[model samples]
Target chain A: MELFQNLAQGFAVALTLTNLLLAVSGCFLGTVIGSLPGLGPSNGVAILIPLAFTLGLDATEALVLMTSVYYGAMYGGRISSILLNIPGDEPALMTTLDGYPMARKGRPGDALVLSGVASFFGALLATIGLMLLAPILAGIAYLFGPPEYFALYLLAFCTLGGLASKNQAKSALAAAIGLGIAMIGLDNSTGLPRFTYGEIHLFDGIDFLVAIVGLFAVSEIFIFIESHGKKSAIGVTLRKVTIPIKDIIHCLPTMLRSTLVGFVAGVLPGAGASLGSFLAYMAEKSIARDKSKFGHGNPRGVAAPEAGNNAAAGGALVPMLTLGVPGSGTTAVLLALLLTLNITPGPLLFQDRPEVVWGLIAALLIANFVLLIMNVPLVRLFVSILSVPPNILLPGIMMVSFAGIYSLSGSGFDLILMILFGLLGYLCRKVGVPTVPIILGILLGNKMEDALRDAMVISNGEISYLFSSGISIGLWVAAIVGFVLPIFLRPFLKTPPRPAD
Target chain B: MTSDRIFGLAVLAVALFYLYSATAIQLGFLSDPVGSRTFPYLIGAVAALCGIYICIKPDPDPNWPAWPIIAKLAAATAVMYVFARLLKPMGFILPAAVASALLSYLISPNVKVSIIAGICLSLGLYLIFRAALGLSLSPFGDLF
Candidate 1:
């Protein structure tokens, strides 16, 4: 009953003219950005952060707009996957396996419409799960002390390395580098600077927003430059638009099962959309009557991953909103947005800023419906975006990044900082070191540090205090298992087929 | 000899410097029992250990691009640096236009299209940021 009341209040806020307009535009822009190869939701959201800030939107408006974009990108990722055999982002990789094969079989329109419906189904169910789960989780979080939070953060870092990167050592190194970067500004407890080198700009610390834009958006430009705008796959033309009602009905069970798998994967600390999609596909494959047809343009293949990844995307937001911890790379970016808006996301957020939380939920609900309605007729429009040449596209993205960053801070130094981070991001990519951990480190470092300090103060510097609480002990055990299990499991886990470059 | 080894060694050097710097952070009188330096020390140690691990077990092969592609990437990076430097002195438009043109041309070596696209992007972004978004940015400056 209370949930109903809260949701009704949320709807009132979301139905406002300005919020509705922002949601629609954000969905449109996110779809266009996500259709581009390699620019996933993280970069899509990162590129648009400056615009959101420049517009001077309030907390609710900004959250609504960004989450809409996040949902839109998930929907849009399948476009390039089916049309060009290029997964638009990492999460979309599994989609390409079945999506592209289905397209090659000449029912491109049917493949696309089916995936879109699957995505809608997965995302809608997961959003409802988030609405129910988040409050209960928040209620539990009220019991957490400093030790529990520190252990939880440790769990985040430990689990993230195992899931996010191919090499654990490199991922750990990236997290360390991020923490090192985070240590640059003035210490919160002590007034002394850690690594400022006497630069005045280092007083407030390296802005994660700048780091995000530099790493995700600017480094993308460098990658594009290196490739010289060459893409080999010719897009499959959508000759006719047809609603695949029969296919939808057949895949409904697959979508339902995959959504369950994906939502669980998403709710976990570090298992994100990529894992969600991969696990969903694998789960469906194991249970199929004929495994031979699984990868050979089966409609279930398209439906499974589409449902799984979208559900995982919604699931990732659960930890981010309730516990102030992000479950995925993109959620880490959203975490940064919430921090920048001066909103501390945790148990208190529900009590203090119910409107912001509830309104965002309502907006996401609306945005999913908007995406379903908009994607079918606009399929032709989004597919055309794939043909946009890198020359024009790269420069245009760069200009938006530059103008946007400059507008936010009006500081030339941040621009330089952005470029340096860009170089760092490029190097990390070249060396197969994931950049997401670095962003996560920067985002969570201070909070993690604060939690540790608070725990120490409470326990008079006894190291055992960190392990004293039941929650803390459980988190520590979970962290150890999460980090170690992946190593042994690596051989057994089915590697998803890589999209042809 | 591998690129991973080189990268690992670079990380090791950074960790060492960061450790040394951690030792140098001045403590305030009202510091907590844990203090600020403890976290930095812990981070430094973790970084050092990771660096050593990476150095000992390097990836077999790192796929680096050709020298020309590397050079082009460097050039684009340089343009961005210059764009940052010139943004304030010359205003957003001039620097943005020039950087956009140079980057576009580098992406696809067509001079005419690059310049037109550059000018149009700079102007168009100016309108979006300044006019539509109501953000502050100078169109032209006194530097020129």
Candidate 2:
């Protein structure tokens, strides 16, 4: 009953005119962008970040808009996976196995419907998990100190670097590079400038919003140019959106199991949705009674991975909100947004900002229903958006980005710097160096430095003071595992025939 | 092997960059332990060590170096420089529209498509940034 009241309160906040408008816009745009190949959820968040920041939106409004896009994109990604045999992000990779086969078998419409239903179920379960887990974790988060936070951030970066494919060294190098970038701007303690190079613009530090635009959005344009904006398999028009009831019933158990698996993967600090989806797909294949049907046009195969990925996306949010640590690159982008809002996450957050917490929760619930209803009937709308031709779309997105940045700062220099960063972002990505750690490094570097310095000051420069509590020690261990285990685990972790894009 | 060595060499060069910055940064008086130089220097040293490891034990090859990275970087830099020159002189939207259109040429297969794409893109951006958002962009420059 109390849950009902809280949800109602959350709904009241989320259903405001401004939020509803932004949510709808975000959902529609998210679906279009996600349906396009080579653009993933992180890229979506990163590209649209400037709009969110410069729109004069409140934290909750900005978050709701972006998060809607985040989940909405997850829903839209299956379109290409089934129809084109391409997954935009790693999370959508597993959907291709059965989805594409289903498409080839002349039931592209059914496959699309199944994917939407499975994703809806998976995301719902995960959001419910988020609603339950976040408050409990927030309660525990209250006990965390500067030491604990420092350790948690360390663990997150380490774990993320660890998980990168065969390129762990470069990933580690990327983290180091990220930390350095994070160090740029002014140091908080002595009012000292760390790496600003005497530039006043950076005195307040590099804006993650600008960085996101440059990295994800700007880089995406360069990539499209490389492919000349040509899509090999144009999406097919679907006659209908609903699958037979038996299809949904057939995939029910697989969906449920994958949701659980995905949620678990998401809750962990660094495990991304791609891993969750792939793992779920593998598990479904292993457990199937009709094993021979595993790879070619199996409804269960389509359901498990698509469901798992969506669920994992929701799960990844738990740690990002309750803890300052993000579970994936996209969540890392959201983490940057949280800092801009001045709403420090961790245990005290729920107590201090119950409305933001509950409102986000409630809005997601609404967004899920919005996604399902809009997804099926409007499926062709999203595909049609893909046919808009990148020649038009790519240039247009660029213009918006530049104009938006110009409007936000009203300073030509900021705009110039934004483009510079955009180029730099393009280069780094092409080099296969991860961009999130850099953003995380820049965004969290100051906070981490502040925490470290304060902890040292409080402890009179004794490094050992960082491990004063059991929780802190455990966190440190987690960080080490995050950094080290991925290197050893890489050889053992199964590499899919083709890695998810 | 070629990409591996290149990456390894790139790593080493970056390590050197870090080291160079560490050594060059002025470490003022010792009153502040964490100075402009301390963190960079620490990072420089650690990065160099890692660079050494990478150089010695670089992984096997992935593929031909993604050559498009160079073209993309060049185009982006050109766009940035073009915008900087235009923003104050030409104003925001017109120069932006032109530059964006030029950028479209960089993306689209044909020049005709690029121009058309660029114009439409500039229009949507104008709506979102100037009108709906009520942002003040440079409106009076003569770059156009």
Candidate 3:
């Protein structure tokens, strides 16, 4: 009942002309950006975060705008996948297998519509799960002691810094570096300044924004320069556009089932949307009587991954909102932003910040419609947008980035940091070290300390309290399972079981 | 052939750094129970162990960036320095446009249109953030 009332309030906020316009613009802008092969959601979010900040909306409103862009990007990614056999990002790679086939078959419009509806249904179902699960988690969270929190924070470090990347050692190295950097400020518990090294800026600690932008945005551009000098190959035909109702009905059961699969994968600490898409795609293909047609324009093939990816996006939010644990890379960036807003997301988040959470839910529901409407008719425009010459397009993006950095602050130092970080980021990618966990390490680094301190305070100086609690034990059980499941499940990954009868 | 082992050893070396720094921090008795550096110490130990394992048995890696590409990127770092050093004196639009053009050149010099696009985009940015959104352009004090 409270969820319903809160939802209604969110709707009231969402329906206002300002938010509606923002949602519509975000969706339109998102699809345009996403249609470009290399300008993925991460780049979109990184570039736009400062702009979103400059708008100075209250935290909820800012979140609403960005979340809208997120769903919009999901809608937009398929355009490139269908037109050009290249996916814009990892999550969309599954879409390309069947989507490009449909384009070759002169049914690109059907592919677009089916993908949109699948994204909507999957996101809607997962949002329902989030609405129910978040409140319950928040309620249970009220009872957690400091030691429990401390252990949970350790779990975040272990899961991300230890388990996420290919090399646990390097991940641990990144985590250590982040922790060492985090320790630069004056110690809160003790008034003694540590590691300030006589610089005023060091007293504030190294800004994760600096690390994140340097590592992600700039490095990405450098990699693009080296790897792809030509237009990211894509098709751009505005063929007859409108998928049939029967086709959508046929994919409905697949969407619902895949949503559940995606949501479950989303709940696990490390396995994110890529795993969700792989599971959903193979599951649908396995169950189909016509399994042989999967890679060759089977409509169900496109529906399954689209549904899985969108649902995973909604599902990934649950851990972040409920426990301050981010299940994926982009969400990790959002977690960092949430901290900068002075909003610590945990169990108390639901009680304290209903507007931010609920408004987001409200905005997501409306955002799907925004994406749907934008996708169905205007997809032709978005498809045509892919034709922009990379020469002009790449420079344009670089210019906008330079201007944004310049306008945000007159600080020449940040510009240097951005370029330096960009180069480092490119190197990290080349080395096969995932960038997401580093962001997660930076985001979670400080809080783990706070949780540890609280746990110590209550334990009367006994470190064993972390292992002593029932909740702590349960969390560890889950974390251990999460940590090892990926390794154990590696064999089954390529060929996920067909939907069980 | 031995780079794999060396890489693993490098990881271990990082871990040792963490362990040394983290454990070195002193936590006083009871009054300030959870003093600063306690969490860092814990993470430091975990990193050190992981590092030691890698040092003992390193995984083989085949692919590395080409030496020439790495050198070219190193040279591009000089361009970034110029962008920062000159952004204000040259005005937001001009310095930004030129800096962006140089960065785009790093992507490819064959695409002549990217530079033109860079100039137009830089000017557009001057209009949007400076003229429209009312953010202060990187101010040119006497350098202009």
Indicate which candidate wins on DockQ.
Answer: 1
Candidates 1 and 3 compared by lDDT, better number:
1
Candidate 2 residue pairs that clash: A142-A347, A155-A479, A182-A441, A182-A442, A396-B121, B90-B143
* Best prediction by TM-score: 1
Q: What shift in Å separates residue A480 of candidate 3 from its native position after superposition?
A: 2.0
* lDDT at position A19, candidate 2: 85
Q: Write the per-residue lDDT of candidate 2 for residues A1-501, one digit (tens) a residue.
A: 866777788889899998888888888777777887667888777767766777789988988898999999999998877777778877887788788877777788889888899999999999999998888888888888777888887877777755554566666676677677766666555555656667888777777677767777776776566655344664555566665579999889999999999999888887778777977888888888888886688899889998999999999999999988788888888887788778787777777777888889888888898898777767777766655666666666676667666666666777677676666666565556666676677667767766776676677778898999999999899888777776777666764563122
Find the 10 residues in a row with the least total lDDT in model 2 chain A.
A492-501
The parts of candidate 3 lying over 4 Å away from their true place are A157-174, A229-238, A402-409, A495-501, B1-6, B18-31, B55-62, B88-90, B139-142
Candidate 1 residues A1-501, lDDT tens each?
999999999999999999999999989988887888767899989988888977889999999999999999999999989888887788898998888888888899999999999999999999999999999999999989999999898888888777657678887888888888888898888778878889999999999999999999999998878765456677788899899899999999999999999999999887788889989999999999999887678999999999999999999999999999888888998998899899999999999999999999999999999999877867888888888777778888898888888888989999999989999999999888888889989998988899999998898889999999789899999999987888888877857665453
lDDT of 1 by residue, B60-125 (tens): 766678898998988998999888888888888888889999999998899999999899989998
- Model 2 agreement with the true structure over B1-144: per-residue lDDT tens digits: 555567667777877876675565554454343445555666666666666666777665543225674566477568867876677777766776777778766665477776666665666666666777666665657644
Q: What is every candidate's C-alpha DockQ against the true complex, given to 2 decimals?
A: 0.81, 0.46, 0.48
lDDT of 3 by residue, A228-304 (tens): 63434546375688766888999899999898998887765555666677778988888899788888888899899
Q: CAPRI verdict on model 2? A: acceptable
**Model 2 misplaced regions, further than 4 Å:** A229-231, A234-237, A498-501, B23-38, B61-73, B139-144
